[model samples]
Structure formats: structure tokens, C-alpha cells
Target: MKLTVVGGGSTYTPELIDGFARLRDTLPIEELVLVDPAAERLELVGGLARRIFARQGHPGRIVTTSDLDAGVEGADAVLLQLRVGGQAARQQDETWPLECGCVGQETTGAGGLAKALRTVPVVLDIAERVRRTNPNAWIIDFTNPVGIVTRALLQAGHKTVGLCNVAIGFQRKFAGLLGVSPADVHLDHVGLNHLTWETGVRLGGPEGENVLPKLLAEHGEAVADDLRLPRTIVDRLGVVPSYYLRYYYAHDEVVRELRTKPSRAAEVAEMERQLLTMYSDPALDEKPELLAQRGGAYYSEAAVDLAASLLGGGGSPYQVVNTYNKGTLPFLPDDAVIEVQAAIGSNGPSPLPVPAVDPLYAGLMANVTAYEDLALEAALRGGRDRVFRALLSHPLVGQYEYADALTDQLIAHNREHLAWA
Candidate 1:
């Protein structure tokens, strides 16, 4: 099978390449295309990709191109990982929202809405091209604001599934703590993308015994520490929430802490600069250790598993993915996209049934689902009003004053990317 990565020039590409090279039997790729407009970055990443494949003795041919259509043509799948305006835009996304005394994150709050507005249109255009060139191809989106982007793709009638490393990362973490294989730890992962909770951890299968409470009893402090939350909170909640939840659960504290530190985007920019330099070394045949600090840990593994299953390649049957809810959550609209465990196959993901949700978590999920509804509207039909409304509805920016000021800041910082700005 052939696969295309649209943002193959990104510093994250090498990590993905390493996975493909290592997991060739999972998703046997015959042709792997790296598509990016940034020629210099693409060459650096592409060279490393080829070397990784060769070093692993994978027989697949690696190709690099700037043309999106040409790159996706006749491919089995097209993976979207592009940043519409690069790290410079992300820097603005991460900083501007902080000016409103809110969380400055790339995937939620005002910053996430900005990303959604700027990203949806570009991704839609790419999806259309893929539809035209390779109608049968599955579009796996690894882009930020994945819920909004994946909703856009699905609404436009593209064959797509959204992938996030959060579930896989949790799976690996929980496995390590339980002293079991990652494959054996099944998370009762529920909620929307980025805003999710591990309600239960089962071993063997979905019907297997729930060991979440056991994990908490033994490793609550460590788990809470990793999340930067107090152990008491984890013990009280009785569920492990996504780290992204910190932006919501501790918005004010996070904002205060964020002000004291450099923006993550800035740090990542420097890391990318250093990573690209390392990538240029002809002797470097593997993904550099520094890439681990660059984030998206286990992203490649998640991508491989999802793509393999989507192509009927005998991948893990059950995995966590973002797809149409179809009533998985009674509180959410049927069309709303939710992240949860699902049975994966060529037809796409079928969300597994979930038990009744506690109102505390369900209420937040419902609130964010509404915000995403408006955020998607802002993204699809560009307007200042739509943008303002989306911000106003967000739990993070519910106040009109903050929403008003944030709307302006978002527009001002992203005017070039927003058509209606």
C-alpha cells in the first residue's frame, strides 16, 4: 500500500518515519510520499526518512514532493499533519489567549478556536483534492484541533478518521504501571478529543476486569504528578483525565503559570531548529533522542495502527479514535465528533458502547461539544460574529469582555490566515 504524509517536512516526521520503518509488518507500505511546500525542511526530513527506512531494511520506496495532489494520487491513505501557518502562527495562538487571562493552548479555548478557523479551510481543500485524486483513500488527521478538523472532513463526506497520541500514550503508561503489554491494557477512554477521561482500565478486553481503581490505589501519586495535578484530585475524581484537561480544570492557575514560562511553541521552535540541524547529519539514521522532548510521543505507532486497520491490514481491532459520536454519548449530538475506543476496520471506526457518564464529566463534555459546534461554524462560515460567539461559548472564555477582547486579539494575530478578518 502507498501512504502520503502532507506535512512531511515537520520535525515530527522523523518520528513517524521511524515507526513506519519499525512497524513495516503492521502496515506494509510500498510507497511512502512526503508532501510539503517547504522545500528546505522537506529535504532535510525526507533524507532522514529514507535513511531510517533503509537502516531498518524496509523495502518500501520513499518519495518527497511539494505537490499535494501528485503526492496523494493513487495512495491508500493521506495523513494530514500540516500547520496552516507554521510555528509562528502557533506562537501567536499560544500567547494571544493568555493576554485575556485565559489558557493559551493550541487545541482548546480561544487559541484552539483560532487554530480551527485557520485550519479547517485548508484541510477541506486538501481533502477535496484527495477525494478527487484518490477517492478510496482514508484521510487520517493528526492535526491539532482534531475534533473540529475531523468534523470538517466527515461533513464534507471524505473518508476520514482522527488520530491522537493521548490514548496510546496513556495505554503505554498504564501498561508500564501494570506490568503488562500495552496491547493488553484497554482503556475505557471516553469524551471528546483532548477533553477525555479514562473512566476504566480493563485488561484482556473491553469485558475484562476493570483495574483503574487498582492503578489509582497503587500509582495515584505518580499519575497525578505526571499530570501536574495534586494526588488528592486524582483520588477524588477516580478517573484519569487527559493532560489537556488542565487547561479547563485549572484555567486561572494555568494562565498564571503560563505567564511565568516561555510559550511551548517557542520552546518547540528552538527544538525544531536543533532537530533539523541534527537531521542534516548524513550519519544520523534514526530519529534523534531530542525528538522525544519535541512531543507527539507514540504518534507514529497510533498512526500505523489506525492506517493498518483502515486498510484491512489486520491491525488492532479496537483502538481509540475520534469519529462521529452516533450516540455513543447520550448527552452529545449524534453528529458531534467524540474520542473513544472503537473497533477499527476498512469501513472506519465503530465506537464501542459506553456506560452512563457521571454528570460532572458529561456536563463538561456537553459544554465543550456545544462550543465546538460554534467553533466549527466559525471555521466553516468565516465572520467576526461567528468567531466571537464561539469564544463566548467556550467554558474558558464565557465572559463577554474576555471574549470580545480575545476575538480581536485572535483576528489581529491571524488576519492573514482568516479570510473574513
Candidate 2:
């Protein structure tokens, strides 16, 4: 099979390469193409990718290029991980929102809306190119603001599925805590991308017995610590919220904390510099340990699993992915993209039936889904009023005063990326 990575220059590429090398038998790739505009970073990442493949004795041929059409032509699948604007833009996304007393984050709140606007158009253009070159190819998006981006792709009629590492990361962590293999853990992971909760943790497989209560009883403190939430909150909810929920559950506190620290994008920029330096070394054959700190934990495993299943290779039948709700959650619109456990195959993901949602989670999910509708509109058809309306719809910046201020700040910080600005 052939595969193309649209942003192969990313520092995260090595982790993906490492997974492909180790899981070669699961998804036997013959040709792998790395497509990116940043030639220098692409070269560094591509060299490391080749070394990792060779070190693992995988026979796949690796290719790198700046031409998107040439890179995607006749590919079996195209993976989108591109950042429309690099870390500098992300720094602005993470900092400017804090000025409005909202949590500064890349994939939530006003910052997330900015990323959606900047990313959706570029991704659609790339998807259109992919569709023209290879209509049968599947598009797997790993980009931020995945729900909004994936919605745009689907609305444009592209064959696509959105992938995120959050579910896999939680599975691995839960398995480690339960003294079981990662594959033996299954999560009732529900909600939208980034904004999700682990409602159930089943051991052995998707049909396995629930062990979430046991886990909470024994390791609630560790779980709470990982989420940066208080243990009492976990016990009260009886469900583990993704770390992103902190921006909602403790907005003011997080805003205060964000103001005291450097932007995550800035820290990542430095880390990328160091990682690129490592990738440049000819002797480095394996993914560096520092890449773990760079984030996207277990992304390689998730990508390989999803790709394998999508290509009809024998892999996990059920996994968490972002796809149309199709009434999985009665509260959400059928077209709304949600992250949940789904059966995967050559036909793509079919979301399994979600159990009735508690009003607590349902209310928030519904609120965000509405905000997402407006955010997507702003992304597709640009205007200051559209942007302002999207910001006002967000639960994080619901007040007219904060929404007005945030809308102005978001536009000012991202004028270059916004066509209508």
C-alpha cells in the first residue's frame, strides 16, 4: 500500500515513522511520501524517517517532496497534519485569548476558532487536490480543531476520517494503571475532539467488563493528577474528563496560570529546534526520548491502527475516531462530528450506539456543537460579524463584552491568515 503525509516536516513525524516501522506487519507500506512546503525541516524529518525504517528493517521506500499533487498522486491514503501558520501563529492563538480572561489554548475557545478559520481553507484545497489525483484515497486528518476541519472535509464530500491521540493516550495510561497491555484496554470515550470524557474503561476488549470504578477507587489521585484536576472532582463526576476540560472547569484559574507561563507554542518552538537538531544527526536511528515531551503521545499507534483498519488490514474493529454522529448521541445533530468508539473497516468508521448521556455532559456537548456550527460558518465565509458571533456562542467567551474584545484580538493577531481581514 502507498501512503502520503501532508505535513511530514513536523517534529511529530518521527514518532509516526517509528510506529510504521514497528507495526510493519499490520499495514505493509510499499511507498511512503512526505509532503511539506518547509524544505529544510522536511529534509531533517525525512532523513530520520528513513533511518528509523531501515533500522527496523522495514522495506518501504521513503520519498519527500514539496509538490502536493505529485506527492498525493495515486496514493492509497493521504494524512493531513499541516499547520497553516507555524508556531508563531500558534503563540498568538495561545496568548491573545488570555487577555480576555479566557483560557489560552490551541484547540479550544476563541483560539481554536482562529485555528479553524486558518486551517479549513488550506485543508480543503489540499483535499481537493487529493480528490483530483486519487479519488479513492482516504484522507485522515490529524490537524488541530479536528472536529471543525473534519466537518468541513465531509461537507465538501471528501472521503475522510479525523484522528486524535487523546483516546489512545488514555487507553495506554489506563492500561498501565490496571497492569494490563494497552490493547487489552477499551474506553467508552465520548464527546467531541479534545472535549471528551472516559465514561467507561473496559478491560480485555470492547466487550470486556467495566473496571472504571475499580480504577477510580485505587488510582483516582494519579488520574486526577494527570488531568490537573482535583481528586474530589473526579470522584464527584465518576467520569474522567480529558485535560482540555480544565479550560472549562477552571477557566479563571487556568487563565491566571497561563499568564504566568510562556505560551505552549513558544515552548514547542524551542523543542522543535532541539528535535530538528537531533533529526539532523546521521547516527540517530531511533525516535528521540525528547519527542515524548513534545506531545501527541501514542499517535503513531493510533495512526497505524486506523490506517490498517481503513485499508481492510486485520486490526482492531473498534476504536475512537472523529466521524459523523449519525445519531450515536441523540442530543447531537447527525452531521455533527464526534469522537467516540466506532467499528472500523474498509467502509470507514461506523459509530457505535452511545449510552444515554447525563444532562451534565449533554448540555455542554450541545452548547459546543452549536458554537461549532457558527465557527464553521466563520471559517467557510469570512466576516467580522461571523467571527464575533462564533466567539459569542462559545461557552468560554459567552459574554458580549468578552466576545467583542476577543473577536477583535483574534482578528488582529491573525489578520494575515484571514482573507477577509
Candidate 3:
């Protein structure tokens, strides 16, 4: 099978390459293409990718290209991990929102909306090209604002599934804590991308015994620490919220802390500088330990599993993925993309039925779903009013005044990326 990675220049690509190398038997790639516009970074990452593959004794041929069409042509799957604007734009996305007193996150709040607007158009153009080249190829999107991006891809009638590492990361962590293999742990992970909750932890398989209560009872402090939430909160909720929820549960506190610290984008930019320097070394053939601190933990495993299943290869029968709700969560619209456990195979992911959601989480999910609708509309058709409406719809920026200011800030910081602006 052939696979193409858009944005293969990203520092995160090594993680994916490592996964592809280790899981070669599962996916059996024949050709791998790395597509990116940054020729220098692409060379560094692509070289390391080849070395890693060779080091692992994988026979797949690796190629790098700046031409998106050529790179994706006739591929079995095209994985989208592109950042429309590099870390420089992300720095603005993560900083300007703070000027409006909102949490300036790359994948949530006003910043996330800015990223969505910038990313959707570019991704659609690439998807259109991919479709023209190979209509049968599956598009596995690992892009940020995944819920919005995946929605755009689906609405455009492309064969796509959004992937995230959050579920897999949680499974691995929980397994480590429980003294079990990661594969033996199953999470009742639910909600939208980034904004999700682990409603249950089943051991052995999807239908395995629920050990969540036991986990909480025995390791509440460690779990809470991982999430950066108070143990009391976890004990009270009887569920674990993804770390992203902190921006909501403690919005003001997080905003305050963000104001004090450098934007995560800035930190990542520096990290990338260091990582690229390391990638330049001809002798470094394996993924560096520093990449662990770069985030997207277990992303390689998640992407490989999703790609394998999508290609009709045997992989985990069930995994968490971002796809159409199809009434899995009765509160969400059928078209709304949600991250949940699903049976994966040749036909793609079919979300399993989820138990009734508590009003606490359901209400937030519904609110965010509405905001995402407006965000997507704003992304598709650009205008200040659309931007304002989307911001106002967000629970994080509910006030009209804040929305007005944020809309202007978003546009000002991203004018170069926003054609309408």
C-alpha cells in the first residue's frame, strides 16, 4: 500500500515515521511520500524518516516532494497534517486571543477559530486534488481544529476520517497505571475532538469489565495530576475530562496563567528549531527522546491503526475517531463530527451506540457543536460578521463585546491568511 503525508516537514512527522516502522507488519507500506512546501525542513525530516525506516529494516521506499499532487497521486491514503501558516502564524493565534482576555489555544476558543479559517480552504484544495488523482484514497486528517476540518472534508463528499492521539494516549496511560498492555485497555471516550471525556474504562476489550471506578479509587491523584485537574473534581464527576477541558472548567484561571507564560506556539517554535538541528545530523537515525516533550504522544500508533483499518488490513476492530455522529450522541446533529469509539474496517468507522450522556457534559457538547457550526460557516464564507457570530456562539467568548474585540483581533493578526480581510 502507498501512503502520503502532507506537512511531512513538521517535527511531529518523526513520531509517525517511528510508528510506521514498528507497525510495518500491520500496514505493510510499499511507498511512502512526504509532501511539504518547506524544502529545507522536508529534507531534514525526510532524511531522518528514511534512516528510521532502514534502521527498523523496513523495505518501504521513502520519497519527499514539494508538489502536493505528485506526492499524493495514486496513494492508498493521504494524511493531512499541514499547518497553513507555520508556527509563526500559530504564535499569533495563541497570543492575540489573549489580548481579548480569552484562552489563546491553537485548538480551542477564538484562536482555534482563526486556525480553522486559515486551514479549511487549504485542506479542501488539497483534498480536491487528491480526489482528482485517486478517488479511492482515504484522507486521514490529523490536522488541528480536526472537528471543523473533518466536517468540511465530509461535507465535500471526500473519503476521510479525522484522527487524534488523545484517546490512544489515555488508553496507554491508563494501561500503564493498571499494569496491563495498552491494547487491553478500552476507553469510552466521548465528545468532540480535544473537548472529550472518558466516561468509562473497560479492560480487555470494548465490552470488558469497567475498571474506571477502581482506577479512580486507587489512582485518582495520579490521574488528576495528568489532567492537571483537582482530584476532587475527578471524584465528583466520576469521569475524566481531557486536559483541554481545563480551558473551560477553569477558564479565567487558565487565561491568567496564559498571560503569564509564553505562548505554547513560541515554546514549540523553539523546540522545532532544536529538533531540526538534531534532524540535520546524518548519524541520528531514530526518533529523539526530546520529541516526546513535543506532544502528539502515541500519534503514530493512532494514525497507523486508523490507516490499517481503513485499508481493510487487520487492526484493532475498535478505536476512537472523529467521524459523523449519526446519532451516536442523540444530542448532537447527525452531521456533527464527534470523537467516539467505533468499529473500524473497510467501510470506515461506524460509531458504536453511546449510553445517554449526562446533562452536564451533553449541554457543553451541544453548545460547542453550535459554535462549531458557526465556526465552519465562517470558515467556508469569510466576513467580519460571520467571524463575530462564530465567536459569540462560542461558550468561551459568549459576551458580545468580547466577541467583537476578538473578531477584530483575529482578523488583524491573520489578515495575510484571510483573503477576504
Q: Listing every candidate in turn, what is its Cα RMSD in Å to the true structure after a full C-alpha superposition? A: 0.6, 0.7, 0.7
Q: What is the lDDT of residue 12 in candidate 1?
A: 97
Query: Which parts of model 3 are misplaced by more than 4 Å?
Result: none
**1-421 per-residue lDDT for model 3 (tens digits):** 9999999999999999999999999999999999999999999999999999999999999999999989999899999998988999899888888887899999899999999999999999999999999999999999999999999999999999999999998998999999999999999999999999999999887789999999999999999998888999999999999999999999999999999988898899999999999999999999999999999999999999999999999689999999999989988899999999999988899999899999999999999999999999999999999999999999999999999999989998889988899
Which regions of candidate 1 are displaced past 4 Å? none
Q: State candidate 1's TM-score.
A: 0.99
Model 2 stretches astray by more than 4 angstroms: none
Candidates in order, TM-scores: namely: 0.99, 0.99, 0.99
Instruction: Give the range where candidate 3 is weakest over 10 consecutive residues by summed lDDT.
Output: 92-101
Give residue 305's error in model 3 in angstroms.
0.5
lDDT of 2 by residue, 1-421 (tens): 9999999999999999999999999989999999999999999999999999999999999999999999999899999998888998899889988877888889999989999999998999999999999999999999989999999999999999999999999998999999999889989999999889999999877778999999999999999999999999999999999999999999988999999988899999999999999999999999999999999998989999999999999679899999999989998999999999999999999998788999999999999999999999999999999999999999999999999999899889889988889
Q: How much RMSD separates candidate 2 from the native structure?
A: 0.7
Q: State model 3's lDDT.
A: 0.94
